[model samples]
Target: MLYSDSNSLVSFNPDTHTITVIRNNIRYDFEIDSTITQQELFLRGMYESRGYELSPIAKLDSILHINVIPFSSDTEFVSLKLDSLNNELDKFPKTHRKTTNMIPSKNYILGFVDGESLQVYYNFPLSIFMKKAWNNILTICIITLLFIFLMFCIVYLFKFMRNLSQYQEDTMNKIVHNWKTPLSSIKTMVELLQKKSISPTDEKGIEKTKFILEEVAHIQTGSQQIMRALIDAIHIQIDRNEFDLKKELITLIKEEKTAHSNQTISLDLQYLLPTTTIYASQFHLICAIRNLIDNAIKYGKDAPQITIICYQDKNNLMIEVKDDGPGIPKEKQKLIFNKYYQVVDKNSGQTRKGFGLGLNYVYNVIKLHNGRITINSTPGNGCTFTIKLKKWRTK
Candidate 1:
């Protein structure tokens, strides 16, 4: 029995002519000739011990390229063959034998001695290093892409929220402006009544009272219109009634002319049919017409000439509102009916007043009646908005 390091133990069995080695908790057995000399046995044990120490180096050689050479004093004794698994070894120049004191140029060398001197050389090629780093490179690329996508989503969400906020603020300002005129009128009437200098029976007093009542009615109508719009936005059903289409247009034109009497805008109505009845929501239809007239008056150059032609063709009632205002650009005609999209004046490069919701509302109202609207315009040639509705049939 022979004990070497704390982890290695060797035992020889004379009867069975076998040697057993226990190293690092692993056991190896080798059969021997029954007449083998003690010196040969010792040499065999030394070889096995040295080979066990080189096992880790062999594993590294399988992953990299390593050269092993044995020397005796200053003379070359033996050189180990390249590992069969190292396919890249043949691509590089062969390693030359060197003296013990000479420094290696490329390979890393490790030297040790048993009974003879041995040196191990290891070389790390670029391809092998890149192969080991491939997983990290892929992980970095995926993380960078995910970060970019996240930033894009965040920026898009912020812009959408900003646009929504601006739209809401503009709508509120328009609502206040709309209500202010009637409210001011009501306030003036009450202040006049507070002055006790006039009798109730006086004609002027009665006229003042009537004007106050008219202002209140106007406020009520405005409130009702706002509520109707809100209901429509929520997709609620609207009430429909049958009415004379020609008469409705004539009445609406008169009302608009009276409302804008202070402005010099001209309103012309041409009726191709004396009487045409249509089943529709009268309030929404009137609102749609009013929006177009108001837009003409607001955006017109000087005395805007608006000509509205109402006629019947086949089974459809066609109404065309033509205005001789600064015409809309060809590019913007398609987007004008979209909510919150406003037309910009090409010459001045300034946006027109209003919330940009009027045309969109008109579009929605017309669609609710199973109608379609189309626009035709050229730069500086004025604009025409044409609406077609299915004629109501009485069964």
Candidate 2:
């Protein structure tokens, strides 16, 4: 094989156990091919035969190359390029770093020759230990980075859960406090009316009494709203009565559509609900769907079109409500479902109130069903809310 550099030309034959060393018109014939069988034998023969007393192996088994060049007269007789000896040695099966316990070095090349019947070894003063050290350092760095990233995620998750638990507790306390005032007012009014007997024909007196009674009834309604809100928040399912969900949805849809024919919201059902009944509370599901439909009507900017779709795909049964509304802003969508929060007009900014419990109730209902609800909307475009429930089978 021919090996070349800017200053030298060298040739070696693996078929014959010989290497011609020539550089600057000088030549030397070397026959060091047969000393490869024994482990220490090669090192001894290399030092003795070539008079190149290079260490067989250094501290930490680091191999050093000894370059041998031949010369004769001022002009030189045979040229010795002293080609790198480790380049070819690397490709050999038994000469790798693990087997030799001697790492390769930089600024050095290794060459090995294999005859048809024997092998030859040549060495030069050069060191590959830097490569091995850098590889080990790189591996350590990667492992350290991975460990740090995992630790960060674990810490973040712990803090998030702790904060969420605190928030839920605060919400529960507020609900209970709001619930007591209306209930107390209702109780006081009822007690006072029971103690006094007033004639029904006392017109003026009866009118005043009716007004008081109406105020008391309004308080009762407010209290019921609070109680229902709390229940919806806590239980998710407003009713525990067993009913076939498909039949219930169909019935409720027909009634609602008939009652609100003026709205002209279209029903587009493509369902594959099993004939077998599901273990679900129908009242909560109805409430959830009704709330979604109401929101669609309230927010839709154009023709107030709504489409209700139900179908199953893969592992989930999906209910999708779509509307061409002045869709909610992405930033405000999450807060819109919070209790006592509502979207108001931009011009007048008038606040329309319904206790702000509708969406929250819907959220709880979906949660009780172990279903996921997602809203997709774009401002001035449209909105779609999809509910996904885990597929189940019942006999």
Global lDDT of each model?
A: 0.64, 0.55
Per-residue lDDT value at 199 in model 2: 60
Local accuracy of candidate 1 as per-residue lDDT tens digits, 112-200: 32222223333334455456678999999999999999999999977776565445434533553366344544655564564565676
User: Which residue runs does candidate 1 get wrong by more than 4 Å?
Assistant: 1-233
Provide the lDDT at 226 for model 1. Answer: 72
Question: TM-scores of the models, in the given order?
Answer: 0.44, 0.40
Best by TM-score: 1
lDDT of 2 by residue, 212-275 (tens): 7677557656655765566556533132345676776776566555434435666544456555
User: For model 1, what is the error of residue 367's alpha carbon versus the real structure, in angstroms, after optimal superposition?
Assistant: 1.4
lDDT of 2 at 343: 72
Q: What value of lDDT does candidate 1 attain over all alpha carbons?
A: 0.64
Worst 10 residues of 1 by lDDT: 65-74
